[model samples]
Target: MTLTKQHVRDVVDIYIRAWTKQDPDLILSIFTEDATYHERVLGEPIATHGGIRDYWQSKVVESQANIECELLSLYVDGETAIVEWEARFDDLVRGIRKRMREVALLEFDGALIRSLREYWASETIG
Candidate 1:
């Protein structure tokens, strides 16, 4: 099936909402059970729903606060969507505030993301 722009936007909206609210479950809800999530270009992809949940719990729920995310751009074709976004948050582990620019490539299986690859750069802003 062809991917629609609004469908991609809806998924992205949930993504931003999940991060802003620090809701791991909400984020997890968007992926398939066997989803693979590559948080960085060189990092190993986290496979399976359990792994994804663990990553989000530690990375977002435990280690970040005051999160905000903005969608900079989005493009969708076929079953894939590419999204660019910026985020600002406090890193509890590092005790610093950070701003990040990221681009993610998402491949969908039905309505859920089956695989996600992300590339990003971040700076300590506070």
Candidate 2:
């Protein structure tokens, strides 16, 4: 199976939708069974679909954050994709709003994401 530009865009779309909807299933649906997710702030990567689901559940659904992700740029080369995204969301715990720009390096298995590493920095908003 080959990955296309549209497929990469669709994956990004699904990712944004998952965050906006705070749906664990939607988030999990986009990852391969053995997918690994790494975040710059985290000490270790989240391994496997189950771990990804649990992480999203806690950071998104459980936190009751409203997230909106915007795709800034995207480039694809075969099974690898590089994406820049901006996210604006409410931080329920901090009782404030925040904005972040992140770059993700994603590897695909067919149309699903096989591995993802993201780097991001957040800004506080009143």
Candidate 2 has its poorest 10 consecutive residues by lDDT at: 36-45
RMSD of 1: 0.9
lDDT of 2 by residue, 1-126 (tens): 888888899999999999999999998999999999997536788999899999998989977587888999999998999999999999888888999999999999988999899999999976
Choose the strongest candidate by TM-score.
1
Those runs of model 1 whose alpha carbons end farther than 4 Å from true positions after fitting are none
Root-mean-square deviation of every model: 0.9, 1.3
Candidate 1 Cα lDDT to native: 0.94
Tell me the spans in candidate 2 whose CA falls farther than 4 Å from its real position: none
Candidate 1: worst-modelled 10 consecutive residues by lDDT: 1-10
lDDT per residue (tens digit) for residues 3-95 in model 1: 888988999999999999988899999999999999976878999989999999999999999999999999988899999999999999999
Q: State each candidate's clash count.
A: 0, 0
At residue 72, candidate 2 shows an lDDT of 96
